[model samples]
Target: MPPTLQSLDHLVLTVSDVDATLAFYRDVLGMVPQSFTPTGGTARWALTFGCQKINLHRAGHEFEPKAKMPRAGSADLCFLSDTPLDAWQATLAVHGVLVEEGPIRRTGAQGPILSIYLRDPDGNLIEISNQI
Candidate 1:
C-alpha cells in the first residue's frame, strides 16, 4: 500500500507579487501572516488558515529547485469556512475582491459543501466553502 498521509502542513505558491498576495489573503480572506528568512536564504511570507498554510515565493526566486513547472497563477485551491456563504460574499465585497463565481453546490473531502469562488491577485482560483 502507499504511505498514509495525515493533514496538509503547507503549500508553496509562486507569486508575481508577494505583498499583493499577502494582502489579499490576510486582509480579504482572514489568513494569519508570518514572514521569515530560512537559514540563509531570501525572505518569504506565509498566509495561514486553520492548520494549513501557503508559502509565497517570488516567481524568480523559489527556495532551491521547486515544483517541476511552477508559475504565478498555477494553483486552484479550495478551503472550508464556518461562516455562511452569503456572509462570505459580503466579506469579499468589503475587501473589494470580486467574486469569480459561485455559492454553488460542490462536493468536498468531508461531504457536500456550499462554495463561493474567488480569484487571488495572481489569478489563482480559490473556493471558499462551508459544509451543508
Candidate 2:
C-alpha cells in the first residue's frame, strides 16, 4: 500500500479585528469570503483564494493574543502561480503591493526558480514563487 498525500487544506490566523482582516484579504489580495460564524463572544471567518482557504479567528479568546507588532518574520504562507514572474511582479505592483525582494534567478534542485516576498495587513509574510 502507498501513503496518500493531498494538497494544503487551509491556514488559520488569529486577528485583532475580523472585519478589518477580511477587508484586507478580500480587497487587497482578492480573496473571497467563504463563510462566517459567530458563537458566544467569538467569531470566525473563512476566506478563499482559488483553492486555498484561510480562516481568521479573533484574538484574546482561549488562545493567547499574538505578540506585539514588528513581529519576528519566522513564518510565511506562500502563494504559487503558473504565471510568469515578470507578469506577476507587474500585476502586484499595479495593485500597490510592495515587493520586499527578488524575482532573482536562483537554482533549485530541479532547475531554476524566481520568487518575491511581501507582507499582509496583519504583517504576515507572503511569498510568490515559481520555477522557471
Candidate 3:
C-alpha cells in the first residue's frame, strides 16, 4: 500500500517581511516564535502551536524546494482554538486586527467549528476557529 499520511507537521509561508509576519503570528495569534540556524545556513524563524509549526521565509530569499510560485499574501490558513469566538473577537480588537468576516459556522477537521477571519501583515487570510 502507498504510504499513508497521518497529519500535518508543518507548512511554509513566504512573506515580504519576516519580522512583521513574526510579530503578527506571535503577538496577535499567540503563537510561539522559534529561531533556528541550520548547520552552515542562515537563521530561520517558525511559529509554533499545538504540535504544528509554520516556517517563515522571506519572499525573494526562500530556501530551496519551495512552491513553484511562492508569494506573499497568497496563503489562506485555518487554525483551531479552544478559546471561544467572542473572546477571540475581543483579542483581535485589542490587537487592532480587523475581522474580514465570520463568527459563522464552518466545517473543521474534527467537526463543526465557529470561525473568525482576518488578514496578517502579509495579507495572508487567517481563520481562527473553535469547535462547535
lDDT of each: 0.89, 0.69, 0.92
Q: Give TM-scores for every candidate, taking all chains together and pairing residue i with residue i.
A: 0.93, 0.68, 0.96
Better of 2 and 3 by TM-score: 3
Give the residue spans of candidate 1 off by over 4 A.
none
Q: Which stretches of candidate 3 lie over 4 Å from their true place?
A: none
lDDT of 1 by residue, 12-53 (tens): 999999888888888888899898888878777899888888
What is residue 30's positional error in candidate 1, in angstroms? 0.5
RMSD of every prediction: 1.3, 4.6, 1.0
lDDT of 3 by residue, 1-132 (tens): 999999999999999999998888989899999998878888899999999999989999999879999999999999999888889899999999999999999999888999999999988899999888
lDDT of 1: 0.89
- Cα lDDT tens digits for candidate 2, 1-132: 999967778766766666877886787567897765545444557889887787665665423344353232234766666777678678778778888988766565457778787877667787777877
How big is the positional error of residue 117 in model 2, measured in Å on the Cα after superposition? 0.5
Task: Provide the lDDT at 104 for model 3.
Answer: 93
Q: After superposition, how far is residue 39 of candidate 2 from its true place, in Å?
A: 10
The lDDT of model 3 is 0.92
